[model samples]
Structures are given as structure tokens and as C-alpha cells.
Target: MRLTILALDDVFDTGLTVLLDTFSTANELAAAQGNPVAPFDVRVVGLGRQVRTALGFAAPVEPVDAVRKADWVVVPALNAKLPHLLLKALERTDVIEAVGYLRAWHAAGIGVAGACIGTFLLAEAGLLNGLEATTTWALAPLFRQRYPDVRLDDTRMIAACGQVVTAGAAMGHLDLALWLMRQKSPELAAFVARFMLIDKRPSQARYIVPDYLAHADPLIERFERWARSHLADGFSLQEAAKALSVTPRTLQRRAEAVLGKSPLAFFQDLRIERVQHLISLGEDLERIAGQVGYADSATLRNLLKRRLGRGVRELRAELQ
Candidate 1:
């Protein structure tokens, strides 16, 4: 399938550069894979033939008419001084025009995606109101404050529900593009990952960590870090307690009080995360089993199957 992406050249130079580079790289990778299907076709659209950036530079832009023909519309973040009269005036007409195009495309069964502060435009256009979205971590508070109706999840690199997809700050744009590629062509996604030297797969979860333990807990945090560093060596709870200068019973009690789980349970979760990470990186199941403290590959297979509903090979295949 040929995907046409209309990238909005907002008043931000750095953000626009990143968006263009990432989109181009992803498209080139997909094309190089030699798939019979045509890869992505991207165009930059804005208010007129040219738009000035915050840094006093001008980026030539395609007319807004291009958006009407796009399969997907992408709005990069606008870094111009906001809450000002100029911004409000621009949003009243030009910004609204771009957003209206996105809404109309959505009505026509086309997809719309936004990166970082661009989500504000999606929200303003009513495409993201009452939808689960994500943006940069630094701006998440401001986003929630301004648009209380939108559910903002900052933990994920990208969050999408329905037709609107929002990505987080910086490199998360690449993750979002990769996800779109994966949906369009799984084989192309694998080829792109190889071309880009990226080994990890996209995660579907909104919050990898549980909500109850969101607050800072120094002991659990320390233990979790220690477990990750020592995953290859395999440490026992007794050893962990000794490292923390506490008795095993005392450590277990404190862990339960703070994290609402026993020490061993938390350790098991960390082990599972490590094992999954290793498996996603293309580690052999037998080697992963030994590295994560399992007696054999069979035991590790059972554990992974019970926890993730998939064995090692299946998980690896899905990621690759």
C-alpha cells in the first residue's frame, strides 16, 4: 500500500528537522526492503508557500491543498511563542484549516498522527478530545491543565486509540513511524529495524509499571536497579537483602509495606522484564534461561508462557 503523509511544517525548526529526517529514513528503509508494495510518500504542508521558524529561518512549504489528498496527516510541534496574540490569530484560521483537514480525513477513514506539542492541534480540532493521548513528558502537565477533557498518558512513547495517534518527545517519533509501518507491513517493520540498528519492538501497554507503586520508593527502586545490573549473574533474595544491609525477613516486610508485594514477587517481575528484554534482543532461550536464573530452558518456557501467554520462540518471532 502507498501511504501519503502530509507533515505540517509548524514554526519550529528543530522539531521540523527531526520529523522530516525520521520520516524520510523510515520511508527509505521500507523502500530498500524491495517489497512490491510502494512505501511512504511524505509532503510538508503549511499556511502558504513559506513559513518562518522561531529561529528566524524560513522553510518553504506546500500549500494546505496537499492535505486534502493525503492518506495521513502529521502535525509536528509548533515551538513559536504561545499564548500570544499572534499564535491565537494564526490558530483561528490557518491552524484550524489544517486541523479541519485532519478531521475530514478521519471521517473518510484516513489516519491522523501528532508528535509532541502537535497533539494540542489535534485536541483543538476535537479529534483528541476524550481520547487517550501522549506527548512530551515536560509538557504533559501543561497539556492536562489546558485540555482537561483529554486523557494524557505520559508513560508510553506513543499512545493511540481509534484513528488519532500521538507520540511523545524526541526519538519517540521514530517509534510512532515504526508502529505505523508495522501495522501497514510487518515484514517492512522488521527490515526497517535492521536498517536502523534497532532491536526492540514496540510495546502496546500504556503504563508498564503498576499504578499503585507510582510514588517514589527508594528501597524498591534500588532493588530493581540492582536486579537489572545483575541479571546475568542471578542474585537471590538473601543476597539482595545482604547487599542492602538488612535481614531477609526485614527486607521482605519493608518491601511488602511499600510496594504492596513480597520481595520475591517484585524480584520475579524484574526477572521477567529482563528475560523479555533479552528475548526481544534476539537472545537464545536456553542462554536467556541460564542468565535469568532458571534451571533449564523448559522451566523458562513455562514461566514465560504462564506470564506472557507466549513461549520464548513465539515472543521472539513477534518482535522480529
Candidate 2:
């Protein structure tokens, strides 16, 4: 099945450029991996044959009707500064007529997506009224104020299930596309992520943590980094507090506020994750135990059996 992508060039050339680059790179990687997925056929479509960008560049555009038969229609980010003329142009009857074509395709089961402020177009078209969606973190407050009924999660980089999907920011557009590719064709997704030099197995937790820490104080960020680096050292809360020049109680309170867990619990979780990674890498139980700061192999085995419901050999077998 060929994937026809209707790339919306919303008068922001730089944003559109980034979107195209990422998508094309992902497609090429998928192809090179011997994955049996159809290559993406991307077309730049705008209000007219000639579209001018915010940076004062004019590029040839396919007519808006070009998207009528697309398998997926995507809207890239627009400039944050809403140009009065641009907004007025987009509101014209002809543009509305063009958008109706997109609406019809969506109603027929075609996939639709928006990244960053592009989500506003979908919202305007009444596609996101009650859905859980997200946009760029900086625009989240305004989005909530404007669309009170829509549940917006600024922490997520991407959210999708079937026909409709939304991404939080422009940078996450790559992640969104790769995720879709993976769902439709896992080989392609793995290929593309590797080609892009991205870790293919990033945790959903990683995406949420950054947004949660977006407005944190510098001290908190510094302490979190310190904790991450010391995960294998089995640093106690009191030891950590002493290193950061704070009392253990104060550290515990701050950690709970920022990480939603007591300092000791967070440390233990981090240590367990590290042990799992090392074990997956084929480290011996005894070596893994000492490396991850456990007292001995027996202690590590007991901890793994209790927490993960498996012994070292069982975990290794699962990995294989």
C-alpha cells in the first residue's frame, strides 16, 4: 500500500523544511533496510500554486485538491506570530472549501495528523473537540484557554490510536512518524530510527519526564542529573543530600515534589533498571551484582526474583 502524504506548507518555510527532511530521511532508511513497506509519496500543497513563506521565500505548491486522494494528510507547524494577512487568507471561503475536502477524506478513514500549532487547524475544523491531544509546550496554555473541552497533555511527545493523531512539538514529529511506521511495519521503524541515530527503544517515561521538568528550578535539574549518574553507585538519600549540601529530609521532600517518589525509592528503581540492562547485555550475575552496587550475587538474585518475578537465568532467557 503506497503511503500518500499531503504535506501542508503553512507559510512557514523553515518548519516545513524540517518536517520534509525528517520524513524523507525516515523513508530512505526504511527502504534501505529491505523492509517491504511502500515508500512515502510526499507533496507540498498550499492554498495556491504559488505559496509565500514567513521568511519571504516563495515555493511552488500543488493545489489544495492534491490532498483529496492522500492516504495521510499532515499539517506542519506554522509561525507562532499569526500574520493577520495569512489568517485572513486561510479563513477565506475557498480555503474552507479546500479544508472540507480534507474532512471528507478523514471521514472515509484516511489518517490525519498535526504537529505543534498545526493542531489548531484540526481544532478549527472540529476534529479535536473531546479528544485527548497535545501541542507544543509553550502553546499549551493558550490551547487550553481556547479549547476548553479538549483534554490537552503537554507532557506527551505524541499520541495516536487509529485514524487521528497529534504531536506535541515539531521535534517530536519525527518520533510520531517513526511510531506510525513501526506500527504499520516494524522493520521499517527500526531501520529508520537506526539510520537517524536515534535509540529505537526510548521509553514513554522519558518523554513525560522532560516536560514535567520543563519549569523546574536549576537546583532540581542538577540534582536529578546527579542521581542518574550515580544510579549504579547505590547512593543513599542521606549521602545524596550531603553531596548537594541539603538535609536528607529537605532532599526527600524536594525529590517527592519533582519526581513523585521518595529519594530512596527513585534510587532503587534506577538501580534495578540498570541491573536489567546489564543483565540483558549478558553480564554474569556475580559481576552484575557488584557493578550495580548489590552486596552479592545471592542478594541480587533475591531482589530480581522479588521485584521482577524472575531469577537471573530466567531474565537472561527472556532477553534471548
Q: Per-residue alpha-carbon lDDT of model 2 for 1-320, expressed as tens digits?
A: 22333433344565577567756776667667674664666777766666666677777878766666677777766655433443564575744664675677678777888776677666666677788887766555456656767776665677774677887765656666676666566766676677777654222332333323423545456566777787668778777888889898888777655444467765665667777778889888788887777778998788777655668888778777
Choose the strongest candidate by lDDT: 1
Candidate 1 segments exceeding 4 Å error: 1-10, 80-93, 198-320
Estimate every model's Cα lDDT from 0 to 1: 0.67, 0.65
Error of 1 at 174 (Å): 1.4
**Model 2 misplaced regions, further than 4 Å:** 1-10, 30-38, 81-99, 199-320
Taking all chains together, each candidate's TM-score versus the true structure is 0.56, 0.56
In candidate 1, position 316 carries an lDDT of 80
Tens digit per residue, CA lDDT, model 1, 1-320: 33444444445566667556655676776567664545666778776777777677877877767766666777767774333432464465667777777778778877788876677777777788888888765445346656777777665678889678998764566677777777777877677777777645243232244322422356666777776667667668899888877798887876655544577766666777778778888887888888888778898788777756677767788778
Q: Report lDDT (Cα) of residue 271, candidate 1.
A: 74
